[model samples]
Target: MPYARLLPPILLVFSNVFMTFAWYGHLKYRDTALPKVILASWGIAFFEYLLMVPANRLGSTVYSAPQLKGMQEVITLLVFAGFSAWYLGQPLKWNHWAGFALIVAAAWLIFLE
Candidate 1:
């Protein structure tokens, strides 16, 4: 079914959102103690793993390992770009966009037969 192809990517995108926040969302709250931030991040990461496990299992049916990894990287970049700009209020510079462009190109290559 079309859902077999569509659902995994969507799930992956959501998982990456959780992961990005788990990894970087703490920067905005520097006043919080290290222990607290670590615990909170770990808590968030648990949810990320929850989504990632299912996404990968389902994605495996439609994509190769490299393709899934490449897709995840691209999704991570897109999500991080949005999160950095909106939630962190840190805009990406030209070099950052150029780097991301290169990553997208690399990901495109992963899908080629």
Candidate 2:
């Protein structure tokens, strides 16, 4: 795809990445007494929705709702993969890739002829 063609998907991908972190990263702070991470995550989530809503609206023009949502779920996994690897420094195991492959296969099925 051309650079311009990639812009919306890229934005959606980034938005989902931020969203995944905002939604799940707070789990790490569960042991803390204050547990302020939930509040912080909510703040971050606001921005995630800000980008995500527009991404869906714009992407809808080019992709049907099912396709857009499918893409969003895949993008969410992709973003979560990176977030898990980077922030948590977790290893990207082969089994994880295998699971993602299954998901990609599902996407193919969803968009199939």
Candidate 3:
């Protein structure tokens, strides 16, 4: 499918992945000194912002501000869930899936005309 509108979603997926890792990866690095952890997180966060900026800009062309925000929120939750499951070795529970489903519904509602 030639989904030109999907550019935003694709960008959002990448942005969320980078952002989630940037945010939570530092938790695992907590054994390091606080200053070092902060510095590294900042470095990673810089890249996250790079991706986020473009994602929002592109999404705005195809969706309203509220819709874009909803998409970002949903993408963030999805990215964090995956990160928790794979990197943190945590299992996804029914409750987690339920919450994600609710979030997805909210996204749909937000974008609805």
Looking at model 2, which ten-residue stretch has the lowest summed lDDT?
1-10
Output the TM-score of candidate 1: 0.97
User: Which regions of candidate 1 are displaced past 4 Å?
Assistant: none
- Please state the error at residue 87 of candidate 2 in Å: 1.1
TM-score of 2: 0.82
Q: What is the per-residue lDDT of model 1 for residues 1-113, given as tens digits with 9 covering 90 to 100? A: 67988898999999999999999999999999999999999999999999999999999999999999999999999999999999999999999999999999999999999
Top candidate, metric TM-score: 1
Q: lDDT by residue for model 2 over 1-113, one digit each (tens)?
A: 24434566887887887788788787667775555877788888998888888777777666777777778778888888888888887858999999998998887677765
Point out the higher-scoring one by lDDT: 2 or 3. Answer: 3
The residue pairs found clashing in candidate 2 are none
- Residue 86, candidate 3: C-alpha displacement in angstroms: 0.8
How well does model 3 score by local distance difference test? 0.82
Instruction: Score residue 71 of candidate 3 by CA lDDT.
Output: 84
Per-prediction TM-score: 0.97, 0.82, 0.88
The number of clashing residue pairs in model 1 is 0
Which candidate achieves the best lDDT against the true structure? 1
Q: Runs in model 3 with CA error above 4 Å?
A: 1-4
Tell me model 2's lDDT, rounded to 2 decimals: 0.78
